[model samples]
Target: MSRIHKFVKDLAETRKTPKEIKTMVDTAFEVNSISQSQIYRISALVMAGRTLQTRRARTEKEGPYRRLY
Candidate 1:
């Protein structure tokens, strides 16, 4: 995994808040070589508490069949 991924994983494992995670990710993108989109992606993954593969699998299982008028 990338350093950003590792950092986000560690933070999630410690139960970091979304605000804190956003601040850290923003700072990383501004002060480091990482891109903002990359940071956003990592933050989202951490918040979701699962790997991208797992998330995609779950979403596919759930489908997009919503009930509405």
Candidate 2:
């Protein structure tokens, strides 16, 4: 699982306000747990991967091991 996911789960489990959560997570992770820029980067990578898969789906629809399976 992602570090950010763990951070969020901790936040939820603790049931703290936003300011409290941020301070606690930052403290727990030494000020490097989660951030908006990092989340945005992950989202961008996921979207790009999906686009790449769609682009490749037309001519190469199955994996190389499909026939063996």
Models 1 onward score TM values of 0.45, 0.38
lDDT of 2 by residue, 17-37 (tens): 556656666776786767755
> Model 1: residues >4 Å from true position, as ranges?
1-7, 31-49, 62-69
Which pairs clash in model 2?
none
- As a TM-score, model 2 comes out at 0.38
Compared with the true structure, all predictions reach lDDT values of 0.63, 0.51
Name the best candidate (by TM-score).
1
Worst 10 residues of 2 by lDDT: 44-53
The reply for model 2, stretches above 4 Å from the true place, is 36-69
| Residue-wise C-alpha lDDT for candidate 1, range 1-69, written one tens digit per residue | 666667766765677765575578667656555554654565567676667567667677877873221
Task: Name the 10 consecutive residues with the lowest summed lDDT in model 1.
Answer: 31-40
Candidates' RMSD to native: 6.0, 11.0
